[model samples]
Target: MTQTSNRIFDEMARLMNDAAGVAQGVRREFDTLFRAQAEKMLRELEVVSREEFEAVKEMARLAREENEALKARIEALEGKTVAKASKKTKDSEPPTSAPEA
Candidate 1:
């Protein structure tokens, strides 16, 4: 090949390599922008993160368990109160007298 044609080919190859590099850089920048925008949108929507949801779920579970325990404790106290009232009533009542002929 002539020297001029070889030079032209080398110039074209260099241009193509530079264009490819620029395209790659643009793609990376676009990906970064898209991810940032997506995260911002999610935040605006008030979306809960997985960690926050899990923590709230666990707290609710614990609260439900505590409520059940309190209910049981109240029932036990009610039973004791009723028993004491029954004993008091029995002790206060007088004995019945026999009937006349």
Candidate 2:
């Protein structure tokens, strides 16, 4: 009776090991399928590559920096022009004589 029980336990253990192996294989297959589907979806969605995204981001950053510099330059030039115009106006004005009461 003990011998029979031992044989049954051994058989059960073997079956469990086989089931574990099958589960692992199925998990691998599912992983592969999921990856393929994800890649296909990305392609369909027209997702850009990482490098392309980074390049566009960098371009935008550079453009912003250049715009800021140009704005500062324009402000400086306008300030100088305004100062020169005010000086000219002051120099061209004639002095008025005081009237006697």
Alpha-carbon runs more than 4 Å astray in model 2: 49-51
Q: What is the TM-score (0 to 1) of candidate 1?
A: 0.66
Question: lDDT tens digits, residues 1-101, model 1?
Answer: 69999999999999999999999999999999999999999999999999999999999999999999999999999999999999999999997889998
Off by over 4 Å in 1: 1-27, 96-101
> Per-residue lDDT of 13-86 in model 2, one digit per residue for the tens?
99999999999999999999999999999999999999999999999999999999999999999999999999
The positional error of residue 77 in candidate 2, measured at the CA in angstroms, is 0.9
Best by TM-score: 2
My TM-score estimates for the predictions, one after another, are 0.66, 0.80
Q: lDDT of each structure?
A: 0.99, 0.99
